[model samples]
Target: EGLEELSKHCFDYAVIDEVHHAQAPSYRKVLARLNASFVLGLTATPERTDGVDAVALFDDILAWQATIGDGINEGSLVPFHYVGLKDDVDFQQIPWRNGHFDIAVLEQRVENSARMAKLWMAWRMHFGSRTIVFCCSQRHALFTRNWLRDRGVKAAAVFAGTGSDPRGESLRALVSGKLDAICAVDLFNEGVDLPDVDRVVMLRPTESKIVFLQQLGRGLRAAENKSRLIIIDFIGTPAIRTSDHSSPLIARRRMQ
Candidate 1:
């Protein structure tokens, strides 16, 4: 339907969101057929899942570039303290697909009571007033939310197809201090901004560098009364990589 609409008429400008997906075959097809005078692509991370630079489709020129570290130094973003916790679940034994882990297997592994207890303990150790816990799946997210609530913490889970009304209600509750934390699947990954979110919990391992950075950016948004953000990354062991590490600390003053 979108392709058909694009084929019908020409436009002055075409803007693509999450523009890194331009390398996808479907996107490539649409872009190739788009008859526009000017094209604009917006994406924080311009790399593709296949490890190809998607910027090639955009003339290979950066209009403007600013990293999270740069934003922090410029005082446009909040400072951060990062804590790395090793994942007890052995993801190496799980099946892998193209780029990411098999979702079904990952969901089962993360939902383990023992593993979730470790996650809960870590959160307790570095508890933040307002936090977002990024889980691997909706089931995992709902489970975490219920677990937190059962322990007297006011929490909620939000994801796509949750309907805008309830999602907005939960977000309002979080902002008003009625909620302690939100257990989210992929809804908070990008675009959504919660300036007052002072803490971010990564309950799932990163599948791509682009996604990892986007998730970290959720807590970097500057807000009044927020001195710094705390990042808790759950590090999972992969099957083939024994010593691989991805760090968000890029030339910034480390918070103690």
Candidate 2:
């Protein structure tokens, strides 16, 4: 209704933030109806996992481009200390379809007690004041949260349709220092600001560079007393690699 009302007015200039989502059906419909002399779309991530060309909406004109390395050097974002650990899970056994692993089978493989125990040890080794653990699924997030909780860590899981705590409440607890960490599945990947998040634990394999950067950006926001972000990535043997020439870290890790 709001978009419909706005569409009635012809504007000289229009700006769309987070334009990476401009390819969505709803966005496409609204954009088609919007009458503007000049439409400017802005997004930190122009490359999308869905293979939609976000810049095509803007006539394929790229105004500017900045890599994560640029942000760090410019002091707009904090630097990161990356630590990559090897996971024992055999991703080769899991079936891959539609550009990613089968979620159901991947979830089962990732929930191993031995893997969780190793992750716990790594977390203890490089503990941070506030942390976010990215899991493969809701069940994986819950299992990680419970495992940490049982070990006397204040942690919680947040995902779609979560019944225990609201997303906002969990975020507040994390910000206020009530919770040490949050184990999340697809919730904090983008459009969330967590400046104080000092640590990010990668508990799942990421096959998209866009998603990898989005998750990394969650902790890269400049915050008071935050010198640098800590990234703990667990790499599986058969992990798919995504490469971006602009980002040396991403290119080297193939963390797409």
Candidate 3:
């Protein structure tokens, strides 16, 4: 209804934020109907996992590109200290197809008690005022949150279907220091500003570079007294394959 109302009139300018998602069917439909004199698309991530070129939608015009290193150098984002810990999970045993692992199998492989204990130990060793744990699924997130809470840590889980009220409250609590950590799925991956997060814990293996960067960017936002972001990444042997070297994190690991 909103789109229909807006479509009745032509606009002089149209701006689409998070334009990386413009390749989706809904976004494409809106773009096809938008009668704008000029359009501008903005996004931190231009790469798409579906092999579609988002930039080509803008008539192949190149505008600007900036990397994480650029943001850190310019003081817009804090530098990061990354620690890659070995994960005993055998990812090769999980089914991989179409550039992604079978999520159900992946979740089963990661959501075990021993793995959770290892994650808790890592977080305890490098504790921070605020932290976000990226999980493979809602079940994984809930399990992690429960595990943290049982240990007397103020934690909450947020994912899709966790309604706006509770999600908002949880985010507010984290920002206000009432909550120490949030175990989340892809809910915090993009379009969320969490400047106060000083630490990021990755419990799931990231297959896409875009996702890896987005997750890393969650804690990179500059905040008062935040000198640097600490990343505790659990990695399976297959995660560091040669194809993964294109990621900045992997590049940094190679240098180290």
Candidate 4:
């Protein structure tokens, strides 16, 4: 009965924002009782953080596959830079969660501080005119934005929770280059296209192949002098060799 209130009057379509958070007690109950005739579910961070279940409980499924090499070999996307940040840097000691970097601890140790400012400034000098930086936390993203803006680089920042109106506004600014740089956490990974983006900075490191692939994809859209995509890998990435990086990352590297 309470769920029906959401369906009052006429509604053509419905979209459930983040199914990853579906298990929240109240949300689980609401989603369990949903009676919508047509519904679409969406999420990026889908797996359970607790390890209870690795798969989503959706009623239907479809899948697609594309390789990083295929995209670049075909001239559809740009190449990547396989970089590793300083090993003994105080920033590298941040916490980790599963295959992802823990944002809270990383923010405290590295993201929103003087050390991070220096790192980003170096990158800004290297890729001055066109670039998109993939960041770790919301605070990290915004801090990079303000720091670069203060330095007169025309930078911007956005996150998953920025709401609809502002999301569109900020995105437009980035694509049009009215905003020279946009720092973000998880939103700019896939299903979003920014062809003019010539460079990418991975200020955060992730152990997941899917994540590295998605982040690299953002700059793969073909463009002018889009000759190479820049990736700054700060962590040691012990088991993962630079040559064995995301297919996009591997495919992007100049065969030397």
Best by TM-score: 2
Over 4 Å off in model 3, which ranges?
Answer: 97-99, 162-165, 240-256
In candidate 2, position 142 carries an lDDT of 86
Model 2, 20-117: lDDT tens digits are: 99999989988988999988888878877889989998888988887778887888788887767778888889999898899999999988888887
Worst 10 residues of 3 by lDDT: 247-256
Q: What stretches of model 1 exceed 4 Å from their correct place?
A: 1-15, 25-37, 161-165, 239-256
Q: What is the C-alpha RMSD of each candidate to the true structure, in Å?
A: 4.0, 2.8, 3.0, 6.2
Worst 10 residues of 2 by lDDT: 247-256
lDDT of 2 at 113: 86
lDDT of 2 at 169: 91
The TM-scores of all predictions, comma-separated, are 0.81, 0.91, 0.88, 0.63
Model 3 TM-score on a 0 to 1 scale: 0.88
> Candidate 1 lDDT (Cα, whole model)?
0.77
Candidate 1, run of 10 with poorest lDDT: 239-248
Better of 3 and 4 by TM-score: 3
Candidate that would win on lDDT:
2
lDDT of each: 0.77, 0.83, 0.82, 0.62
User: Which residue pairs in model 2 clash with each other?
Assistant: 207-256, 208-256, 209-256
Per-residue lDDT of candidate 4, residues 1-256 (tens digit): 7767644544455567655556668777776666666656665435444543313555445243345666677888766665444533353465557755666776766544555655665575556356777877788788777777877877777786652226677778877777788888788876687777777777765555446666766777778766776665555433243223342344322211
